[model samples]
Target: MSNNRRPTIKTVAARAGVGRTTVSRVVNGSDLVSADARARVLAAIKELNYVPNSVARGLVTNRTNAVALVIPESESRLGSEPFFAALIRGVSGALAESRTQLQLMLVRDQAERDQLTESVATRRVDGVLLVSVHAEDRLPGMLEEMGLPTVLAGRRDAGEQLSYVNSDNAGGATEAVRHLLGSGRKRIATITGP
Candidate 1:
């Protein structure tokens, strides 16, 4: 029977009279489970209203079910930049829905960068999300070669080979200019930042 507290895999295992590993295999849809065990596990899941925690499932499957958001920027930039906040919010919001945890990595210098790279190499995180990479940055290539899933907020350049999402700055500027010209403005001044 379920109560106010949530049910875990162990609870389901006890109810099903199977080992935790067997329960995990069944929950993860591994073919190693036998017919009778699968049936029992399913029954226990239904009876106890068991909701498999993705984090626990990841542990049994040799995965952390966690992602690292690596931002190679100093505290100043992280504090001042609006994009970083927005990026964190968007990623965090989506991850929250899936019960996956996020590890924020703000690498400020070479020492921290080395540490972050070491963590990635040690398989501490399931995947990496890199932001604010320069045109010549090699982190993306290194991560890909290491066989880690990676995503970038924006590309280094037009010839960037990695998967990335880029802003349409030029398109937006062109549209602004066209809007002013269409409105019969005699002159339009463009302002930019350093």
Candidate 2:
């Protein structure tokens, strides 16, 4: 404990006078372990101050328990947009209930996009949540082709195929236009950004 060398599971098992599997089962809280072995492992863990490595456990379990949130916008835009902030809050709240870690990545151009694609390709995350829907965006298609689970905060258009979390922007626009027409506005225009 003082030599700066980390104590491993094997060391704990040795100190506990039990096999490695017994220690593993005890650490995992498996009922397969007898009462006596569990007690010994617990005592050894305390004596060594051993901590379980969640990352290694994730490797064995095939679940990193993490998801990526990709925002195709600059940091300035992210800070300025209330909608994006609200989207992040909702995403965070949902993930907190499920006990999953969220990794936020900003992809404003091709270079950043490529980096994101590589990270996903390496199986570093379980899934992706994309924001900033654009007509020319290629990330959703690329993520689908790479076999990674992907979703959108919104959609490029009415015909968007990816799963999305969105409100009724079209309906709201229609209601606003109707109100303007009834109020006798001479000219009304809806401008979706180009």
Best by TM-score: 1
lDDT of 1 by residue, 1-194 (tens): 53778888888899999999899899888999999999999999999888888666666787887899999888998989888899999999998998678999987777887888898888789989999987767778888888888989888878777788888999999999999999999789987766
- Model 2 over residues 99-193: C-alpha lDDT tens digits? 79899999998899889988898888899998885888788999999998898887888888888888787799999989998999979876665
Per-candidate TM equals 0.74, 0.70
Candidate 1 global TM-score: 0.74
**Which segments of candidate 2 are over 4 A away from where they belong?**
3-6, 15-17, 25-49, 97-99, 168-194
What is the model-wide C-alpha lDDT for candidate 1? Answer: 0.87
Clashing residue pairs, backbone N/CA/C < 3 A, model 1: none
After best superposition, candidate 2 residue 104: deviation in angstroms?
0.9
Which pairs of residues collide in candidate 2?
none
